[model samples]
Target chain A: MTAQALALPRAPRVDVRSVAFWVMIAASAYGLWTLKQNSVPTMLAFPPSAALNVAVLLSCLAVGVWLARRVMRPVQAPPWNGTWLALMWGGLAACGIAILMNTRLLSVWSQSLGLEAASDWSAALTAPLNEEVAKLAGVVLLAAVSTRLVRSAADGLAYGALVGFGFQITENFTYGLNGIVMAGGVEPFTATFQTLWIRIVLTGIGSHWAMSAVAGAGIGYLVSASGRSAARRVWVAIGCLLLAMGMHFLFDSPFLGGLAGTLAKPLINFVVVMAVYFVVRRAFRARWTAVSAEEAAAGTLTEDEERSLSRRRSRRLHLRAFPAGPEREAQARVQRLQLALVEERVPALAPAEAVQPWRDAVAEARAAR
Target chain B: MDDFKGNAVHGARRVWVPLVVAGVLLALTAVEGLLAKALPASEPVPAGTVIEFGSTGQVSAQVGEGWTLDRTASDLHSGLLLTRGDVSVRLTSVEFSAGKPDNAQEMWDGMERLLGVARHSGTEVWLGEPTEFDTKWITGGLYGSLQVDTAIGTAFVLPADDDAEAVEAQVLGPFDADQADWTAATEIIDSVAFDEDDDTGETA
Candidate 1:
């Protein structure tokens, strides 16, 4: 079995009885219906173009999600159900909340500052505060939905990226519809393509996903049982949120206009996220190594196996030593159990006594081999 | 489950954390709602009043006294919208900000594109010959008549000082509008002027 099998020590099943589950369901229903009502007439008027826009946006979303789920997480993806929940929160709940909040906030700015100042400065003022907080709320709610869903900064990063992707796709769809009206409804299909090209192809890389990923990592740090002090976690979480907001402000602000500036802003955000990712990954690897060493000293892992177990490639190479059949299968099973035990033991999450069951299972599997 | 005990919020009270966050969001939205309600929705402008609009108050127009400003829809940044009887006037400086559709014809075409966006469809739009659109305060602008559906009204793309900005105005009314009301609307248009001295703002 793959390390994915080892990633299931925490419950993956949804608890329908939980308050979070029902809340998510209600929010999604209200948000999706409200959004549909707003967009239905336009969609009906231009069915073919609307369908094309949805198809293209959905395809982009699928690709983004596949990348995050398959390649982004450290050891394994978050549970499949949890991944869906993150998307739902971003697309439905967050966007739906933002429509109302942004409208009110914009009207306030327009009325107070006058439309003159509001037109130029309102978006830069409103979206960073309203949109970012709204999306981040979903990340927090997802954690509440499953306490085990986010145990490390890496977990937060994955969930956050998925959520952002969802928001981005839905936003693209809305923009695609508006593009028709903007182009005067004369060339509806052409207008839809133009909007998609700008929203999806041009600015998609460093948009909602990048911002939410940064904030979600903060949530992970806050909720994680990693040995950081409470104050540090709180500070880091706040720092990430502010940083995300700043990035959003830059994107919406009037400072950087034109094609080159458009390209540069997203690039700036992409680089920042990559840097944050490397830092989080480095910390996670350090914890992983410490647990591997601890298990090795207890003689649960042979010295050779301990060295090879941490890397998927090395594990595959080590498995070659066993003959094909039950022996190789048993060895693979032992490797998976060892990983689960090591993951659970890392940091302050599990004490030695609590980890004994995983260790005993690995031992029995090893003895069978 | 036992291992997760110490890890809840990294130690108890973890489940309540998200709930608290939800409470904060609810509170923020509530405050926003209250703030919006406190804003004045509509305002009345006195007759024969010269209204200075846009960022620097560069564009000035005198009202003939019947139109009530749609305060909720009006913005100092983009001019304003007002109405009197069956006639509605919308003034917007989108051209100055976007830097496109430079002529009266382009502005008229832009209106055609804007109709669907404004939820008006299957309408006929025809424009008249170009003429001078100037007032005592503003000069060097294009003026024309725009026919929408069966209604006809005057359209002006009045230029701002330094010729860097222009405000597009449309006064729409029925094809067979009242003669006295139409004359008053014309006087209102004739009063469109620009303040050449104010340079504090760039666009609406």
Candidate 2:
């Protein structure tokens, strides 16, 4: 069967200019307002240094977004647009809410009960529950806003990681700013720089992003699964959150260090990073399988095409088999057609007609070759 | 369908969209930076004063003379560490989560385990069983003493109050003889106070 024989059906494009999107935007604005109010005193405390630190951090965040997008492109991942949205609307909002909920409210609640605001035990006591819930809320918000975009577990995971990264960067900046003031007007830059290096560079991935991605997978399941029982979905969601909290607790607690000595922290971080990687990798593999199966069933994808879809090495090897120029171009068209075909077949992705021109181009390229 | 091909111009615009959005975010960040710069500096929290921790003024304490607030020892609700003259006294209050054992004995046992006394043999000197004692804020509470070989030396761990599931506060003293001004450390511990009206307390 030739590529021309394959039909390209159309689905209605899901627009992001809806009332719900604006409403979510408004909610984020409100959260930001609250955050500013809560942060004013600290901001004023370390003004000049805080400004410089924030500027540097903002630049770093931009670079981070650019880097993350670059990493995603190789895997034919979703657009960077949604990742930015999750960061701004989801991540920033969650950060504001977390500050209010965890820092202000939870502390009051704990102390009202005559509890020792066990500052040392914060990672286990306060952070896991408040931070996870706040961060996960952003994923939930994105899912609610763009159901079509976040149609699968992988999408949920990617968006969730973006949200977590956003929260982490903003929180890190705030922590650095606070650290400046706490350093009691000492070497502000040195204090702020040390804080940034440790929080931003050292523990960046193993912190919020890893935790939220797992929880977002659970969110992915809840939204994507049509026939699952409500009870089952609730349990899955709870289990994912508990796992996220457990990871956060481990990272925050001194328990592991006590057990493994100095090796405890890095060991825990390694275990967490590996666990999250496997979980997300498995989800992506499952989605890829589903996409391949659909394309194969439709006769749009040959066995060779499906083999390339299975692994990055296979895809690269297939491309390298062709010489440069027209031969390589033709092979590249085949790869593009495969991707377009999957998008067409995958539920709630881009419409088939949108990719029709690419299919025709591939057909022409093959004929020319 | 009119060729179903997106125009080259439209594709180019799509590419520019991310850059435009990023530019706007960067501009907003710059504005925030400007605002931060404009703000007047906050008055520094004075040393040796009764600085309130969190919204719950419930956890309030004065750092000893020449001691500053050790934020590393502080959290969302709790304050820790009053350092002066080679001695540092750490005061921490932790609320137990629901469904956890609340008895004083179990709590002390947990603390012992946390300090690695039960796990690491011969590393710590456990003085004896906890006896009933009273701090300024807490009345009729179980208290015990231990000497950790590590940086965290002599410590007194005890319950904050007599509630069935009360918060636990520990006052860690110095183990080194040179830094062993137990009188000043005890005074710092005694100065620890908790307010009943948490909602009305300062949000610092």
What is the lDDT, from 0 to 100, of the residue A353 in candidate 1? 82
lDDT of 2 by residue, A56-104 (tens): 6788778767755544222555565567777885446777666654544
Query: What are the per-residue Cα lDDT tens digits for candidate 1 across A75-160?
Result: 55667888998899889888888887888888777667755567678888999999889888877777667666677787788888
Query: What would the per-residue lDDT of candidate 2 be over residues B1-204, giving only the tens digit for each residue?
Result: 322221111223333433443344335445434543444322223445565553344556554455544443345354455565556566655444312344566666545544432223335545446777678676656666555444444444445454323334444444553444555666666655556433322333
Candidate 1: where is the Cα deviation over 4 Å?
Answer: A1-10, A302-305, A308-332, A347-349, A367-369, B10-15, B42-80, B84-204
lDDT of 1 at A330: 77
Model 2 residue B84 CA deviation (Å) reads: 25
* lDDT of candidate 2 at residue A332, scale 0 to 100: 72
TM-score of structure candidate 2: 0.57
Candidate 2's docking class is incorrect
TM-score of chain A of each: 0.91, 0.77
- The TM-score values for the models, in the order shown, are 0.77, 0.57
Number of clashing residue pairs in every model? 9, 4
Assess the local accuracy of residue B81 in candidate 1 as a C-alpha lDDT between 0 and 100. Answer: 80
